[model samples]
Target: MPAERLDKILAHHGFGTRKDVKRLCHKGLVFLNGKIATDPAVKVDIGSDTLVIDGKKITLQHDLYIMLNKCRDVVCANRDGEHQTVFDLLDESLKHKFLGGDLHCMGRLDIDTEGLLILTTDGKLTHSLLSPKTHVPKTYGVGLRDALSEEEKLRYAETFSKGFWIDREQNEDGFNCAPAVLKWREKDGKFTLEGENPALYEAVEKNSSGKSDCLLTIFEGKFHQVKRMFAQMGNQVVYLKRVKMGELSLDPQLEPGSYRELSEAEIALLKQRQTD
Candidate 1:
């Protein structure tokens, strides 16, 4: 709620750049509480006042938190070259809701994977969740090799048993990440996948047919970690889905490629969780 220069405040609200803001002010296109304000450097309280630029009312929008049930084939980026980015799924009306900068995905999922993806305008929140120092947990559901072996499961669980740290590649800023936690679960004769010590003959037939009967996974956010882990175990990942991150889960009611704003309580809890 602190006072900020009129031009900077307008730009932050997605009006335009500083130059554009100055032009708006000088041209008498900017108004404060209904009166034309021509001074670009004039200080105004950003959190408590309404602004009008060229007759369009711009209210100070609170930090936005949105969850999108990302669908397959959509890239997890703000801009894309060959595929549709997640932002494409948002309608124009909702797109304008973003006052300034584009929304950022907290963590990424491959174009082939589908599940909960969190988007927010708050940079600090995104950094908190993705930062290795925070140790935020993420859970993924995976479809393992049809004829997965017990030995394969143990290998994934104990790959780093020797306590070695492998650094991942760096980003443009030279920030790198170390390995993350990995674990797995075998669905013992579940409804979706069946195998009750079914005769060896039955197991062989199912294996040859390329049908999986168990799920394998862990709560880790390493780059291509799930797929690579399975590959290391000599099994190819047939399907992958992120189920949870931090304290948020995909709402059962949300459909693929759709999004809704987060509730006030949800936002507060998210910040609180980070501090805790």
Candidate 2:
């Protein structure tokens, strides 16, 4: 919202380098408030002033927030040597638009993980979201290698709630994980509540041969935390996909490898959650 030089703003928005924007100004291709803007050093209020280039009005936005339904096999990076990155899924125009900004993923998902990934040029928001003090909850839908027995399920839930020490390669003594929530899902996509329906439990038991599904919510992000938690319980996470972070869920309409800008309401909700 602060005033910035016209050439700097143009360069930041991917119009071109400072020299290029100055050239456009000299050519009378750049206009400010309906008048030809020949002084590249002229300062303008981005929020209130209108900028036109080549007869087209240019919207000035200093920040960008993108929600991507990330697909598996894509790394959460700008570049990867052996795999496609999440940024690679973005269109060329978007890449160019934020070229001068620090566009990056707020939080990373493993190569095998899929689902909601946020890319942003707002570094402050990213810091708030990733700060450990925020304790923002992230939910994941998990595919387990094997179904848990009723006793095993109870044990797993209780242990997770109480927190447990898990081995980490960096620390020989390992570390204690924070408490997490676990919920079991029936085969028909309904949550299986305790003593709600014996029929649903039997159905899940019969259908689950070597695989089952559950949802896990954790407040903190650690290296391979979800997979490590399952491994500590003697189970394997065969598949994992993030479904929610804070109050924002992945848009069901967005297919894998597709993305769109977050709405104003969604952006506000994330900021609210960060403070809470």
Candidate 3:
């Protein structure tokens, strides 16, 4: 979004190599502001400059952001033993690029959990997203092991929106948490898991696994926070999947183990969430 070398901008936009851009510049094929650019090294304001190559405009893309639809049996850590990690779900090319850049996750889901995850080399963005001050809400699609009565569901909903206190392991005393947004959906389906819990995965659909599903958006990320909340409600979480984080949702097209690059607009949305 700042001023940069014309050729570098063009190359970054995937127009061509720097050498190719130089050739085009010299051949009067590249135009900027109705004038032919003779030097590829010319400085241009990418945010305002109108760049045309072979009679077409180009927009330059910056940075690399990834959206991963995480699945079970994979850890969120950089490296773990005897279990797959989120990085393993990436394409080899992405893995290499990310590792070389020292990319990291903004937040982590448990190895048995699945859903939306943002992986990036942008440290500032990652930190901002993870910061408590930002209060970026993360939404999860949860599967419960118990059914609740209408009266109980109302109590749970009221508790979720009004906030509550929960017990902690580190201290006998507990902490008060901010209210979260929740959407409930009753289900009679079986869960599908990889290696973490096979029995839950093997159960037949609509065969009374006795589970309820809900979508929850929490503003905080404590260790096993969602599980604790459900436990406090006298319910057990049998399966968990993250569906959204900030303004980014899990790409519906992506399979459990697949991932894809985020668009420039998507990146903007995420940054907006931090400041909003």
Candidate 4:
């Protein structure tokens, strides 16, 4: 990377304005490679040189990626007057670090929906993931108001695979969804698949009297698409939560409204899966 003015770099990192960084330099709070740096205009290599401000080292990176286990009722925006946003869950230090950069969510989840939400400062990666042509798969765990009959399950699966128009009255105005995969969950919280273990049946007999649970994987995102699909079939979606995106799954240990930086391996795998 090219060298930049010390004050410019500090301001870019949200230490403060150029004037504020100059003030900090003059006050002997800024150090460059172990020496006091009083000249704000002095150029420094951000990637190679060490910068310390007020006894704390500043580690600069080209991009930042964060994984947040979102909770219900939180909007996926940077700012909202009426409701709390996902950005509010991040630590204040991180918010200050990327103050001037283009930090945003990869995609949005409804205010009532919960689960995996990704926030990043990498605009290129964000665009690649959100592009309609990418067709990345997103998986959601859904809770229905009532259980589906065996015939209804088979019928709904086929209907979803064939794609349907969301708006029946105004076909031109409505959007058509892409083919999606729908799998019903058995009573033991396992998907009903062929050649399952006999133990699964024992558990099903022990606990099989509740609302239906299923997993839906869709390649395209539409406004309330999952809920609408269920509603069209005369069923109601009581709860919704995203569980996976591409090859990245939400960390099971992460609590609601909590977040952590993505590991280097996870970030690489996410990008790799996009191409695959």
Q: Candidate 2 lDDT, tens digit per residue, 100-175?
A: 2678998999998877899998888888999999999987777888877878888988999888998875554457
Ranking by lDDT: 2, 4, 3, 1
Question: Among these predicted structures, which one has the highest lDDT?
Answer: 2
The residue-by-residue lDDT of candidate 1 on 3-66, one tens digit each, is 7688776776767688998888889988898899989998777678778889988766646688
TM-score-sorted candidate list, best first: 2, 4, 3, 1
lDDT of 3 by residue, 1-276 (tens): 557788877765555689989989988989998899998999887557788998987654345688887878899988888898898777664543321145678688888887678888877788778888888887776778887777887789899999998888565446676898766664434333323223222221122233336667799988888988888888889988776677666666677778888888888979996642
lDDT of 3 at 65: 86
* Residue pairs in clash, model 4: none
Residue 93's C-alpha lDDT in candidate 4?
A: 69
Clashes of 2: 0
TM-score of each: 0.67, 0.87, 0.68, 0.83
Lowest lDDT block of 10, candidate 2: 201-210
What TM-score number comes out for model 4?
0.83
What local lDDT does model 4 show for residue 72?
Answer: 84
Q: Name the best candidate (by TM-score).
A: 2
Candidate 1 worst ten-residue window by lDDT: 199-208
Question: For model 3, which pairs clash?
Answer: none
- How many backbone clashes are present in model 1? 0
Better of 1 and 3 by TM-score: 3
